[model samples]
Target: MRQFPLEMHHMAPGRVVEWRLRSTAGAQSPGPDGADGTADRRASFNQDKHFTVAEESRAADDPTASWIAVTFEVAGPLDEDALTGSLLAFVRRHEVLRCEFRRLAGELACAPIPAAELALDTVPVADFDRTEELTRFLVERFKRSIDTLSWPLFTMGAVLREDSATVYLAFDHIVCDGMSMPIVVQEVERGYEALRRGELPDPAPAPSYLDFAEEQRSRYLSIDEHDERLGYWKEFMASGDGEFFPRFPLELGVEPGRMYSIVNEASPLLDAAEAEVFEKACLAVDGKPFMGVLAAVAVCLREAGGPGVYRGFMPVSERGRAGWGNSVGWFVNTMPIEFDASPGRDFEQVMASVRAGFGEMIGHLDVPFVRAWELLAPREFAARSWPYPVNFFSYIDMRKCPGAERHEDWRPTSHVWSAQANGACSWFQRDAEGLHMNSIYSDTPAARRTMDGFLEALRETVREIARHGSFRRPIALTPPRRPALTPLDVAAFARRG
Candidate 1:
């Protein structure tokens, strides 16, 4: 590992530039609590202990060759004083936020701390035209640091003026899963508020990211505890061809670009009458609405001309310990739901299988997903057996969104970024407010269109299952509105299209 010059340069009152020494040895360090010392941290997480970062001299042809950045547009008016301090405090309160790097045995690794050497860069707010640029920078940064903490894999850009401002978080999947994002944002809000009030905010006490890594290792070692779950996966994965599922044709092949998406409204079945039925259905008779969603999605794949072997990936939270309610770490386990997608099979049959499957897996939910894959799936090709790939479904408690609802102190925006993994994924979350579903498909135009069509078909399929309790052919619909385009429209359209 190379030593980083121990130099600190001032950028502003709240930020500074500091150097990190990369670790030469790619060895995983013991967690702050020693939870993962015995376990194979790298093997279990499918990630290494350390990652690398380099800054190249900027050139005319390579504008983005050196670093990743995100700049936001202020909403109503700019409040530089409050916003800037909040951002500085935000970095200080979170250990991952103040990261330093160095080499250990030839490996570049970042060390965690409760306080970071803040290097804040305040650019002219006028530089950004849209929020996309910041997100794009984050995407590039994540892609470059794919192997390490690649935890706190999230970044943000904010533009706060008196009238309005925007805040964004660009995330990396390894360090933080989608499930844990809300927790991080919530803390940021709390810290930002405390800074604004000139009070020290109380942060949640839980295992740090490094601690979680330690816990993962120890947890995996409890083979006796995980035997049942491991056994189940052994049997479950034994049936598949041991290949990582392909990226949903939608998300492939693109220089990471930014895309804006909103969750789709819930299906009509979520209404009172159907709500009871849905609850009872999810209760145990068959897979509940959660499992039912997966089953229905499996059916959608059959209708979409996808393979018959139905496999849905489900991510369950691993923050089961007390005081970990809102800890920011990647603690997700993906469960595989495999079934036959035969045309004649009734929805009830599928639901029953999925329900039973959920019950069986729930018993083994404690198993580390990485370890589960290692034991049950072949090491060389374990990636293919991810709970579900290309075609899968997820359910979320959407009723209570995970943040302060009042707009007094902060405003929140949602966005989807690249995980750099190879597959398309979709998640459905619902709460008292309503139902919302978002699918991440390959970036390829063809795959995107396929996902769009598949969603429409899945909606129809679920409607039939909920109301009719059986399958029925859906009528194809005509295309939606299209705009007339000229050559000029093509250029401007391409720019703003």
Candidate 2:
């Protein structure tokens, strides 16, 4: 599955139906009596705590930084009732979905909702005669409905047609991660099919994100700013001249202390066969595909007049253990890495440097990024967002994720919307179809030009590594796909974070 902005989604014209959860509170009906909910609470993991607290302090009312969503299609006409039941089952199966977060006495607390106390409300939004109209309506609806500060922080909907239906579900980032998208697709499909055949979609209870967070905080909360475990962070900061975050090497032309509308762009780099060849080439160099991708990015940036030793933030998965693998939540930690991409370095040489850098970073993953930042940069910790746009990169091999085999037929696509950003972040994803890159960055004249050139150069460099196992310095690069910026409008750039 690919992750792109909803603006790029292909929405078909059809009747729109929305499904949301309603607490069974105050219902007098005795048909399905459930126990009262509790105040069972725990300290959130560092990431969640930082995010929620930041939301509490935001001055902007933009709800654009609200959600990560998935859209997919299933065969047959709409079955509103069966689908609702299936969705309810899906939520009940994931404990994290049953959670509601709030600030209890200045601390972010996660309150768990019993599955039985949940109820689904199906509403017929409206019918649209055109895809453009449908897309416009849904984008607004998503921004309006999913709020990060609220409980039941998710929304679901579908477009109904005679032969097929498209399903879309959106959740606040506090409750899910990129890896959670495929799990949603798989479970929803299974539940819907089973419910249609009059079979129970009950599956084994997945592990709880609440428990995971509690355990994590319990272990790391006691540490102080002087802990030796933070040595890696200190060295990384020192490498950047004692700065905590790396700046995107090239000029983005952004002013300090201001946020701008974010640009979301996604496109393919290599097809499936080409990606396989790339993988084989990487293996030949004693490195993995992700390492190769990083190497190419390093080289491309270096060619763009960046530092010879590339340094930036990389997001590593925290779901390392077995139990949390299938659980849905924000299971990620951002760490810093630096590798040589100097002139005269071949692809294989850079790959070796990346492999070593990645290994060293992995060994230091025990220290949570949030904790490290709180200790190292407390002043910026209280800021509305990252102190400045952070230099960021992420790579995911989705082919190994759960339910990937069905991705071809399911057509599941994940989406992330950002209200604004000061810098750029790029995610590289490999799946059944090909290798794709999704980027969100500040929308400025210089940023647009820089990122366009960087992405194009990186693309060509990666293709060369796949075909020849190594490449010389970048040749004359191609012009960016869009030479000029398009006007950001309500349908296109409607919501602000």
lDDT winner: 2
Angstrom error of the Cα, residue 385, model 1: value is 12
Query: Which digits, one per residue and each the tens of the lDDT, describe model 2 over residues 1-497?
Result: 77777877767779888887977854442221213434455645654654565475554554336578898887788777888988998888777787766655666776666778789988888999987788788778777777777767789989899988889999878888888888888888878888889898876677877788888788888988899999999988888999999878888989998889988888778988889999999999999999999998888877788889999999988887548887878888889998888989888788889999999999999888888888899888766678776779999888888888777666788888777788999999997777988899999999988888887788788889888999754543445564443222222221122
Query: lDDT by residue for model 1 over 286-315, one digit each (tens)?
Result: 455676667777776666655665765577
> Which residue pairs does candidate 2 place in steric collision?
419-497
Every model's Cα RMSD, please?
10.5, 4.9
